[model samples]
Target: MTAALDAIDRAIVVATQDGLPLVDRPYHEVARQVGISPDEVMNRMDRLLHEGAIRRIGVVPNHYALGYRFNGMTVWDVADEHIAEAGKRVGDLDFVSHCYHRPRHLPDWPYSLFAMIHAKEKAQADSLAERIACVLGDLSRGHLVLFSSRILKKTGLRL
Candidate 1:
């Protein structure tokens, strides 16, 4: 496992989550705000990426405003042995924004894989989900398509 990050390292993560500046001296700007040397900022970011403290550093946009207004959480009950492969296949679709495997909660439900798909309208999103389900075939045990009504919060983690 990776070692825990120090306070400074954590700060760097919180600061850069949105994205690094698109300039020749981007680290310099980050260092100025975080009160560290540019080289130190670069080194710390490298360490964070290598140690898995951070995933990818990139920009996150509001898909809705960009015309992908319809967002749906498509859950699937896929076989345990094939869950990973099925999730990968669904994630490969152009409409899929995120996809992963989650444990099924019993009694009332049993979905194992969850994928987020975004499109211009509900029909398009639903069609995309159906196509993904068809691809999984027998491995797909059950599926639910839940359309998003609103976004409450979208922010980065605070250090």
Candidate 2:
């Protein structure tokens, strides 16, 4: 099913995604910039969320700034039948900020469930992954843990 988004809706999304205004009246500020009433901006935002155009709306804190400098991408070779269950379980963990299934790319590696874990240090991140593996069961075909040594860029969606 497709939901049509009018110009105003598009504008609201584009503007907000760039970074919502930081002020006492952020909605009003955004509305003024978009040439719409504050009510209109709010209505559009509600509609967007209801229609699933926007899954969620909130601030994205910088993990590094929060002293969570160690980040890692963990890959697990979960069975096809258990991928959904395992993914959901892993996604629910607080340490796992991102989790999803992706097609396997070989001959170097083959893993289905990909998850990103951030922690104060490498050992902590690795420990979290190990815990997740234990919870998901050790029957997985294989698993790989990769730590991030650098961050190239971190930004919101570009519309």
Candidate 3:
């Protein structure tokens, strides 16, 4: 079920959804745009979070600008019975940005778990993949890393 957002709540989301302004006081900036006090803005944001209107308020960094040029989606062929445990272990790693389970395709694709890893160099990415493999141990039937050739804009749902 979706959260019921009033006009003020909708305004707040619209004001900050693109991204909070890069100002000294982002909340104040949002308040100015939404015609509310800074405190009210913050209070409403807190309530919105509790209501599940927003998942999180955090940074979306440009990894390429940060010199993390190697982006790979590492796929693993894991047994169904052990997928939950294996996914948690892989997702807990510091280098893993994203991890989840996916359905396998018979005869061709056998990978069931996917993890995204980023590094400054190809060798570093390969080493990270090896580390993931070591973590998986015998549970990992096989694995492969598919590197991204280009970057894509990451955005959240529109208001």
Instruction: Estimate every model's Cα lDDT from 0 to 1.
Output: 0.84, 0.84, 0.94
Question: Candidate 3: deviation at residue 128, Å?
Answer: 0.5
User: How far is each candidate from the true structure, as Cα RMSD in Å?
Assistant: 2.8, 2.4, 1.4
What is the C-alpha lDDT profile of model 2 across 45-99, one tens digit per residue?
8878888887787877777889988888999998778888999888898878889
TM-score of each: 0.79, 0.83, 0.93
Candidate 1 whole-model C-alpha lDDT, 0 to 1: 0.84
Could you give candidate 1's per-residue lDDT for residues 1-159 as a string of tens digits? Answer: 288878888778767776777678889988987899999998988888888777666667788778987888999988789987897888888767789988988857789999988889778888898898888888898899988888866765655
Q: After superposition, how far is residue 34 of candidate 3 from its true place, in Å?
A: 0.8
Q: Candidate 3's error at 78, in angstroms?
A: 0.7
Give every collision pair in model 1: none
What's the candidate order when arranged by decreasing TM-score? 3, 2, 1
Question: Highest lDDT, which number?
Answer: 3
- Give candidate 2 misplaced runs (Cα > 4 Å): 1-5, 52-55, 154-159
Candidate 1 wrongly placed segments (more than 4 Å): 1-11, 17-26, 35-40
Displacement of residue 22 (Cα, Å) in model 2 is 1.9
Predicted structure 2: lDDT: 0.84
Lowest lDDT 10-residue stretch of candidate 1: 150-159
